[model samples]
Target: MEQTETPPPGRRVALAVLGLSAMTIMANATVASSLPGLKRHFADVAGIDTLAGLIVTLPSLAVVITAGLMGWLADRMDRQKLLAFVALCYGLGGTSGLWAESLNAILAGRLLLGVGVAGTMTLGMTWSADLWQGAARARFLGLQGAAISVAGIVFMLTGGALAGLHWRGAFAVYALILPVAVLALLALAPYSRERRRAAPVAKGMARQAGFPWAAFAFVGSLGFVFQAAFYITPTRLPFRLEELGVANPLAVGALMAALVAVSAPVSLAYGRIRRHVSAMSVFGLSFALIGAGFVAHALAQDWHGVLAGSVIAGLGMGLSMPNYTTWFLARVPMAMRGRASGLLTTAFFLGQFASPLVSAPLVAHLGLAGAFGAVGGTLIGLGLLLAVAQIWWPEQARPETAPAAVS
Candidate 1:
């Protein structure tokens, strides 16, 4: 593996790139918050509730279908350029709802937004892995998680606020991606071209590196579980809050923000945590926190208890995401980084897409509180099982060390 002699971009530039990456997650956050507004606007449409719900979830479906193709493209093309193009599409497709005359048209726009998000997110992680390594890589991955958490808070609040005016106002947030596309062009374009020219490894070398099937399966599995659990907050928490007699939308937004707020600081400290604990231990702890948070949510009789539960759950949410990314990056060859990242993205969003399906039945059968209890108990059991596995088969829990040169 030949290292580039050219200095990496400044921290500001790196942050700018990562900031754009954050926008990918915000696609669903704001739109999910605006679902009620959309539902009302399209109330005359048959299956209007389901149709409006798809506006929030359809992008995940797109990502699952297209992320692999986007990842393949990233490996062969100029990633920075691809990022800019996708960002432009993200803005256009995301805001398409504002002008769309019909529910079907809005759904079409969401599908397009999904395409843009797939490319942007897969490429963003691939680019980050390319630019950083070792402890810095861990820290940057943490920052990526932190950035997404912060963006979720901001976007969710903005969506809730805008939903008060009109669902169209919520779509306005998508236009912010246009400026991010410009930033990608200005800050990353030259560097990407430089790296391509300076690279010494042959294309055949990358091809011969071979995919890490076991590692991919392991990470993808974990990604699915983590995402499904984390999504319970966004998909179900608001309604739970409403059931508990906290019906103000802003208060619901505030509580949701609390769930993610702790994630930012916790994610920022992931490097430090990684230094002391094994990856398996980190996963176990993250699951434990999530389980504990959900149990609190199950038991809570008031809003303050919900806030406490969110804070604890947020800690788990923060740790689980970065830990998975760090674990994946550590094992995969650089040549396969994009493809592997795409698979991970697919697994994650597939979980996001499935969360409601898996949990909805439970909600109906058990009621919201019982549903929380069931999920909490399951997560705690998983945490305990993983912890025991770590003790019994520590070697298996650790990431595999890849060859020095991917070729």
Candidate 2:
């Protein structure tokens, strides 16, 4: 039976896709509350502090390597099946740390977890673009972003409580994602059969145009910078709290949750905002706010300042998430959405993986506060320049609407 080119998302399909989106947050930050304890647990090992930090960010390294490939596969394969398989990988790999006896073992599990992330996130987004266009796409992505932030809030609180019990306990939360694999398979079964008949057409369309490398480089850079700067909150915030004399895992979780909490409303409002301003203008404003938030963190005397920084930065983050995805999708051809989404995912995760590597040395030399100040300063300058450029060169401000998917 021939499947319609792009069916409207039914409840199950929508849930499966959005559920996959939520896991992207759980993929990394679910363990954020445990970072300090993990460091303490592995204190005997040299450079364990840095290695422990990797537990949160290391899946990104795997995503950096595999997201492009996963994207490519999505264009050619049954994305529904692939997404389901990866969800299983996400569950198994994420839970491995729960039983890991050594830091190396845990890191190995993180790499596998990254592979799962590359597939789930990339394919979930590809499905979104496949299923919707224009205003519908924008609205769905906004809802998707909000769902992710809400998941982050839940996972942060859950992880923090788990970490308080035992650092390993936090890893168990990952197992909860196991059911998503079944959900994807059952929800997408009809699409899988329908899409199979359209495979040849998709393949033909894929070769009609060359990949847009230059355009992607610009978009990719935007994603990278946003991630690198934003990751400072998850990767280092716990230690920052420790320095400020708040060491409880639950407290760290609450603060991190607070950071994500504020982003939810901003994400929900993204559709309205996108209608009024260019994506570039939104990026400019978001970056400026994030920079200011970091500055607040740098000057903070207690957790109150951290809370203030989180709220400020969270708003920017909310704007940035939906904006980046929308901007990238606007440029992607329907046939090539998979590969493009994968590459964009890679760019984003590469920034995440690079964050700790870059920040560790900065923290070593400048101290955490000074490091925050320096990064905040750079982002603020860059944000202002982007804003000014958007005003002077309005042509670049307005994004082209995405090419409509073939039916």
Candidate 3:
């Protein structure tokens, strides 16, 4: 028998990774929540309101362009060194909002900020997967999902408080996330690209390397749909509620929070679901529930309709989020993780950025009902493709009887 040493492990690495993951969520959420305040400051500098949302979302475009390239590079380089470099990018890019006086400057800062988010969310996962295995990997993923939710919760709460002090002060809070993420990674060593085994000569390993494509497609499409349905709702809801003679900002915030809150517990419980159900079935169920939520939102005449819809869809996302990421990591060789994940996260972010473009025209032409009705249709299309892909997955994952003859 050939001797193979296990990858590095210690409590320090696990906590560090978890802490890093947790801190990242807060940074992402805080920037988004504090955007309004930042806009007020930048509005004088940039002479724009429509473009304010652009500052926040513009990064996704950059992330889509960069994430895969970086991930592929990570396969051939040191991930921690890359993450450390990006953390500086995060801090510098994030802080630029404080001093940026021109629209162009803000746009440049936004692109950098996008790069930081991409590194933490995508590469961090790859690193952790490289470091852990079996149940621990599953546990860490679950915690990552929960930590992301916690960040959202904390950032929103903190943002509301800090926005009163100054929007710049609010943004300053995001700069802290980069250092914390780096330290946690340094101290904990959560992932293990350093110890990857050589590729085995499996009869169909080359073809097999494509194993996670369908799942990746599903996750990527879902990210875009999530952005469209979840994000567009808040902007549009305020208008729709105005049409109904309700203009209370407090009520709207409460309702939206309730919707997202629905996903947190369900996301944490994902590990339990995996033990009993096939990911294909769960993915289908998630899509169906999300579609139903869209339909409910389309038909909603009152707050109750939207609230009910969000709860249903939140449950779907909560259950499916970590599973999708883990599913991809599990099937690929450690050596290719950076490239593979870069592609996956890029797809996910690209979908997120594309959501508004894809759905806004429909919303404009058809009214909320017609526009959201269109979203349900898109989900059906994605879900159908996934269902078919599921049929082909088992054969692709079968153990290789012989090594591939790669020249």
Considering every candidate listed, which one attains the maximal TM-score?
1
- lDDT digits (tens) for residues 10-80 of candidate 1: 87668766877798877687876578777887889999977877888888898899998888877777777
Please give the RMSD to the true structure for each candidate, in Å: 2.8, 3.7, 4.8
TM-score ranking from best candidate downward: 1, 2, 3
lDDT of 3 by residue, 1-407 (tens): 11132454676776666655655454334666566776666666645777767766777777888887778667665566777877777777777767777667867887887787677666677766666554455556766777677667767777667766776655676677665765665774433333322334321453555545665565666665655555565556566555555578767766667656877888787666666655666666777777777777777788888788778777766766676666666666655666667887776676666666776788779986777777766665666666776777632221111112121
- Give the distance in Å from residue 263's predicted Cα in candidate 2 to where it truly belongs: 0.3
The residue-by-residue lDDT of candidate 2 on 38-126, one tens digit each, is 88888899998779867877798889999999999988787776876787778778998788889898899999899999998998888
Q: TM-score each candidate.
A: 0.92, 0.88, 0.83
Model 1: worst 10 consecutive residues (lDDT sum): 396-405
Clashing pairs in 2: none
Sorting all predicted structures by lDDT, with the top scorer first, yields 2, 1, 3
Positional deviation of residue 114's Cα in model 2 after best superposition, in angstroms: 1.3
Q: After superposition, how far is residue 273 of candidate 3 from its true place, in Å?
A: 0.4
Evaluated at residue 197, the lDDT of candidate 2 is 84
